[model samples]
Target: MKRHLTHLSKTILQNSSSKTLPLSRCLSTQEAIERRHHLFTLEKKRQVESVGRIEKIEVRYKGVPKDCTLVMNKDISSPYDCARHLSEWHADSNALALIDGAVHWDMHRPLSENCTLEFQSYSSTEPQAVNKAFWRTCSFLLGAVAARAFKEDVTVKLHSFPGPDIRSGSFIYDVELSLPAWSPAPRELITLSAELVRLCRRGAPLERLEVSEELALEMFVDNSHKAKQIPSIARTNGKVTLYRVEKHVDISKGPLVCHAAQVGRAAVAAVHRIIGSAAGEPEQLYRLQGVALPAGVMLNHFAFNILVERAKKLNPARSPFSPFGEDGVRNMAATA
Candidate 1:
């Protein structure tokens, strides 16, 4: 099977008559990275350009510092923009923005018409949405960490991640590593955590983009696994959501934390080398697990140690692939 796959790859490369369609574009992992970034940039520009005339919408801001009205551009301003008008602290510390006291809105997504705005911090009374947003951000950031942590020789293909499940004790990321059957040592986990810390130090603002299925598949052409998932992900509304940090873009239904600086005290707890005995599937994969506390959550080392131990156990949330089935990674009810 391995030899057949290698021969097929060579054949595809040698076939000079194949039309270089956008989705059919031949690419390396590095090229895939660049292509996705370029697509995001272009999409953003297109959205901005589509607004033929600038119109103002009143946003009744109802959060910290003071309540006020913001005359924002229609379909142009986002909750993050409103936060910027309030203070840098508001803009940076907020995890999710609630519009009209309901509807969790992404910090980077544009405001459509008019609505009241409320910001939710990690410590808010109803912290469930905010916590979920934080967990999703962590999962997304873990992908970035995994992509950058790898040596150039190894190909790092991010598959996808399950929705955020804080009660399950940790955020999880499922990735395809070139090392078919490899497990990391404790020192390696520490090293990966250090890489995550370094990324947080850089402080990239997570940006969100919603595109048509055609565009989403085009963006993920180099990643077979993500491309496969796009159709199912878009089945609900024929729209695909993507999040970007710096030059990296990955799929997620997101209302991620405003900035990376909000993440603190994170550790890669363990890597579980999992094997699938079922027919017609890759035999081996690794599930990366980690525990984190938001920047201001001051848990003592003793309590945090307990969380770390719990995280080492397999997170019981739904799996990224086949999230709602018998062969599923986990049952969805567990996440609730």
Candidate 2:
């Protein structure tokens, strides 16, 4: 009685005619960047417009220039704005904002309420948090520069970066590129380094934003991997943290350095192919790596070359290919 199941006919395909319409012209890497930047700008403007009324809050400055309470706009003024009022030195050197003796905030992230504020530099007494932030920023910039370095034909899909490890001697960015088996020449690496240098020279302030999971998904629609990760990232707090510099934007668990200029000397040292996966499928993942020093740090070319050579060795960061290790590669919120 159960033997009546029949397989569906194999082709219907024989009768169905297919037409290939001209493929929609794909966006160039630079165009894609501009598009994303436009979206980010519009959303940022909307958030600012959502603040119906201006309200003032006190931001008590600590450390150099003595402690004092300054009136700041609630949800409007940021640590950066406060710094600008004090001195140019405060505005430029500060990397992270220490608030109320506890929370470490992004300098560009707005002050939500009355809080005690102290700025952290690369040379602060307890600089662990600031160091992590600078490392993370370098990794983020690596993605931005590398993505822009490729030609229009090569697709660049940025994956997650493991949390910053300055001890490892390099910051990392994992990306999937269309050039599956391509090996980079020395000239290519030099070009990438030059791109990083140009970007840092722009001195763009790194803007931090928190948005809903839905919006995060919208922002990263072009990136399937990031879209997949956003749900898990937003699960904990129902929001995803994003950082933007110039026309490039990306997600991160971050208190990124105040500005790109803070990365004074840098080199795009190596890019290692990450092959093999739990699925055992051929993957196009590449780990773009670099070494960097803060603005005030001094190193001669010979000494810096030593650091570059050290960074050329494959970094020991967690591979995005490993889905089910200590933390799932897709569960970026955990590792990042």
Candidate 3:
């Protein structure tokens, strides 16, 4: 699959007259997405190759179907792989992987060392971690849909998303548009929501990768806003973690749900404008908000409508533009 994508990328680049197309061009979105996905595939392959010698580790599994120890390949096997050794139900229902007793890890992320492993589903007794992961994934997918929803004339620059507040009843992504003034009609919002549902229905696995600061900068160089935020994000660990769903990639401090299909029902409830107060702030920011429920979660239409109404209101979550100095930037990057 990686080889096929690499070949396809080369074909795309060779077919184009210009090496790089401007953001305003219609073909730019497709070309940029292909290039980034190709890069991610290559980088991931290289990292896997670097882990030359394979070693075995004991993964003490906990949860249903009885607890047992499974021998997994270190730096090669992920929690999802462990699930595969169990049952299809384990793989399909689990949303996040909990390592030891505390750390929430991505299902696709490799197990570096031996530790107690447990899967957290949306229906877990204590669903806080899974809920947060689901919310964060929703916000990330919102950015993905918004980036491609408009025509070529409209240049969409994604700023950043606030931390997930599940109790607040909505997920969000703050975006900047080239348009001076515009409002989305109800139908338009519905269209965006439908696009999101279509993407999720495809059931793409949310792939996670942690890259060096330099590689991350190269990946997001097209977006000026993300470029500026990268340095602040890399300050803590000198690396940036990225999540990719299909062809779309974005920055986030994530332990996102295993697959897009986990977002059962969702709607693009509203897009509220955020006005900048300071001199260096953006001229205008549009907050794209959405409401979503987990797969198999049955809610009546009236109750769901109430949730949608609550999501339509401006979420009181902290503004991405709020001043936090260096510390604030770090905190924002950590959650965003």
Q: Largest lDDT belongs to which candidate?
A: 3
Cα-based lDDT for every prediction: 0.75, 0.80, 0.82
Name every residue pair that clashes in candidate 3: none
In candidate 2, list every pair of residues with a backbone clash: none
Q: Tell me the TM-score of model 1.
A: 0.86
Off by over 4 Å in 1: 1-26, 277-280, 320-336
Per-model TM-score, in order, reads 0.86, 0.89, 0.90
Predicted candidate 1 versus true structure: per-residue lDDT over 1-336, tens digit per residue: 121011111212212222233553455455567678888889989989999899999999996677899999998899999999999888888888899877999887899888999999887998888888888888888887776566444666775677776778888877777776666766677778887776776788889888999999888887776776777777779998888988778888777888887888888887776555534334555678888888877999999999989999987654543424333532221121
Comparison by TM-score, 1 against 3, better one: 3
Task: Locate the minimum summed-lDDT window of 10 residues in model 3.
Answer: 1-10
Task: For residue 155, give model 2's deviation from the true position in Å.
Answer: 1.0
Question: How do the candidates rank by lDDT, highest first?
Answer: 3, 2, 1
Q: In terms of TM-score, how similar is model 3 to the real structure?
A: 0.90
- Tens digits of lDDT, candidate 2, 1-336: 112111212212111111111111344445556666777788899999998899999999998979888999999899999999999999999999999999999999988899999999988999899989999899999988876776555677888788888889889998888775767878777878888987897899999888889888866766777877888788889998888998788888888989999999999999899885556333658889999889889999999999999999999987866767424665544455
Candidate 1 residue 39 C-alpha distance from true site, Å:
1.4
Candidate 2, TM-score vs. the true structure? 0.89
Better of 1 and 3 by lDDT: 3
